[model samples]
Target: MISKLELLDNLKEDTGQLWGKMSAQHMVEHLIYAVRTGNGKLNIGCFNPPDKWPTLKRFLLSSRPFPREFINPIIGENLFPLQYENLEEAKKILEEEIKDYYRYFEENRDALLLNPTFGELNGSEWEAFHEKHFTHHFSQFGLL
Candidate 1:
């Protein structure tokens, strides 16, 4: 349950350091992309093959934390280009996307979400995934 308030509170002038190339702004923008994908705003297919989906989904939903400094297939190498002009703009957009994420589940409870790594998931699963994801990145920036 990593809320926007917590994220905003922890986002200082100097948030991230040395783990990866993404600045705090870049991390926010990256999160926005992920949220968009979860809410069905961005329709990207799963990178993992169908045979591996069950295992991937299980791991994603498990309590195990995401590994640090792992390459994200969706964001790295400018696969999905960043759109924000600055950190403030990225944060604003991410906040809006967070709101939309809740709204999306409220509207479509039975919808199957296709994550680029985790394949199909329901609304509740998507929320859990997001919580884990946000926690991971927030920690990456030493916010947690």
Candidate 2:
């Protein structure tokens, strides 16, 4: 699974034809939110119960790829309001957030962040989650 940020440059508003309603800018902003969550900037709680986190995290950290039709329970079927001016700006912010994530983890190795889907995650777990997530979205836009 590819997790390269450079691959995101290949996306255009019209790029993805496979499935889902996300525009290119929406996808970038989504990624920005995800990185914020991992870096403790979002400060959200997990949706799953405590008992479910172990199982969920196991699934998350596994090598299996996310299915194309899969949808998060929180994000449902609708599109979210765009947060950036445009796709380019969204991509730039996403890059900044990714840099923040690296810096955040390097400074606070033991910090635990809530992932909404995976409960509390340490830096390494968040890293794994981000990689899998980026791979999924990048593949959706044919950037893989």
Best by lDDT: 2
User: Over 4 Å off in model 2, which ranges?
Assistant: 1-3
Q: What is the C-alpha lDDT profile of model 2 across 47-86, one tens digit per residue? A: 8899999998899889998778777776788778997888
Candidate 2 vs. true structure, TM-score: 0.93
Computed on alpha carbons, the lDDT of every model, listed in order, comes to: 0.80, 0.83
Deviation of model 2 at 36, angstroms: 0.5
Candidate 1 worst ten-residue window by lDDT = 1-10
Report clash pairs, candidate 1: none
User: How well does each candidate superpose onto the true structure, as a TM-score?
Assistant: 0.89, 0.93
Least accurate stretch of 10 residues (summed lDDT) in model 2? Answer: 1-10
Candidate 1 C-alpha lDDT tens digits along 1-144: 445346666685477654777778778888888899888899889888889988987888889998887888866655345677777888878888888988888899899988888888899888878888888878778777
How many collisions per candidate?
Answer: 0, 0
